[model samples]
Target: MSDAVLLLAHGTPNTLGEMAEYLDKVTGGRAVPAEVVEELQHRYALIGLRETAGAEPPPLTKWTLAQGQLLGRLFFDNGLKTKVYVAMRNWHPYIADVVAQMRQDGVTRFRAICLAPQNSRTSVGLYRKATLAAAEGMEVEFVAGWAEHPLLIEAFAEKLRTVWKVACDELGKRVPVLFTAHSVPTRTVTGDAPDPYPIEAKRTAALVAECMKAAGLGEQDWRFAFQSQGVSGGPWIGPTVEETLGVLREEGHRGVVIQPVGFLCDHVEILYDIDIAFRQIADEMGLKLWRAESLNDSPLLTRALAELALGPYTAGVEVAPISARV
Candidate 1:
């Protein structure tokens, strides 16, 4: 059987009009008001103006495609003949469509691994649903639970080390670290059969913190917070990074290293939520906020994905259980 790899992620709209459509799909047809749409557009405008290596901003799809290609190349280098695909959860080339295309391409055996390292039922679980639903009669194995992988921990720690140094140099003192992940509803993870998402995310942060200490970076001045909470929420997780920032300001901290452990690439969350919205708050509070760059097509990130793909993955588990053999 020919092997295929599907790099699954939550997608963003390519245009402002598409944003409303994207919101509709993700929110399960809930009505997103005009004010919310305007706010999202503002965030997108900020993201659009922020230049990357050129005078124009790069699309999230471009980065995600690059990541998928790089991951396929890594697997090939590691002696696996593979065809890689990029499947977005809420945009064009949706997971279902991608799977259909793969079937047409005669790929009967494949692995679908979410781009999110920390597996929450709402996030990774949704990816699993989309993959399995479209994978009709094919041998599909979903990979999960690589949040504590050594390579991933090392990758995050490297970025944290670099950004932490910047924060220290700017503030002239070792400041506190705040790790963040995209927040979902609190109950989705707190009910009877509680999800391992929060615990796994915290574990990744803890591993990075331990690695930082071992490298003589600084003491364990770190706390994990949730960020990029969606609108129309009765209550997402907390203490949010914003709330934490306020607390840090009140606590007399002058600088903070924002390490986003939950995200693998630079998207709306990292671009607008952290770079723009959070930065504005930090400026008002006289706090120095520096976020480590996301693992966007990083060699280390490719290594992590390649390892997860090659690792022993268990199938037939209802929760898309994955074991890290690293």
Candidate 2:
């Protein structure tokens, strides 16, 4: 049987003109306020301006495809006859388009892995539903979460260690490290059968913290927050990064380091949200902020994804449920 690995990601608009369309897809064709679109347009423009200034913001759509190609090469090198396919949930080369291409390629079955490490019905569930709807004739295995995958944890921890010392030295103290993830609506994970997202997300942070201990961070030196919360409505999950930063400042901290444990690659969320918006808040509060780099096209990330694809993955993880994961 011909097999493929379909890598799904939350895609970004390639240009400002596509912002409204992207928002429409994200909100399931609901009307997004014009102000919201304008705000997002501004954010996208900032990223573009950063690219023009030569810092080269992470072009998310490109990064998603690059990550898949790396995974495809890794599979080839490991002697697995699995081709990798890139599908964006919100943009071009969408789930349906990619499934049609796979059909044309004569692939008989495929495994779908959402690029999201921590799962929530809010995001990952939607991706699963869409993929299943598209790939009607193919056998699909969905990896809902891989939060505690050792290599994945290692990738995040490695990122923290790279900047841990500088963040401390720059401020003349061991600043608190804020581990963060994208926030979802409160009801999505708290009502009914609670989604395991918050639990798994914490474990991912704890595991990464444990890895940082080898580099001299303390047990209490780190905490968690949710960032990039939607402005769409209702109470989203919290303590938000802003609130957490406020608490850190009140505790007499002069600085903080932010490591977004949930995201694998740089997108607007990391680029615009953490790097731009969060930094503005931190600066206003006189709390120096350091952001850990995203693991874009990291070989370790590919290894983690590969293990998830070719499982029976049952060990070397700290807090992930082995067999019960969705």
Judge candidate 2 against the unseen true structure and give its global Cα lDDT, from 0 to 1.
0.84
- Off-target runs (Cα >4 Å) in candidate 2 are 49-58, 313-326
* lDDT (0 to 1) per candidate: 0.80, 0.84
TM-score of each: 0.90, 0.92
What is the lDDT, from 0 to 100, of the residue 166 in candidate 2? 91
Q: Clashing pairs in model 2? A: none
Error of 1 at 15 (Å): 0.8
- Clash totals in order: 0, 0
- Candidate of highest lDDT: 2
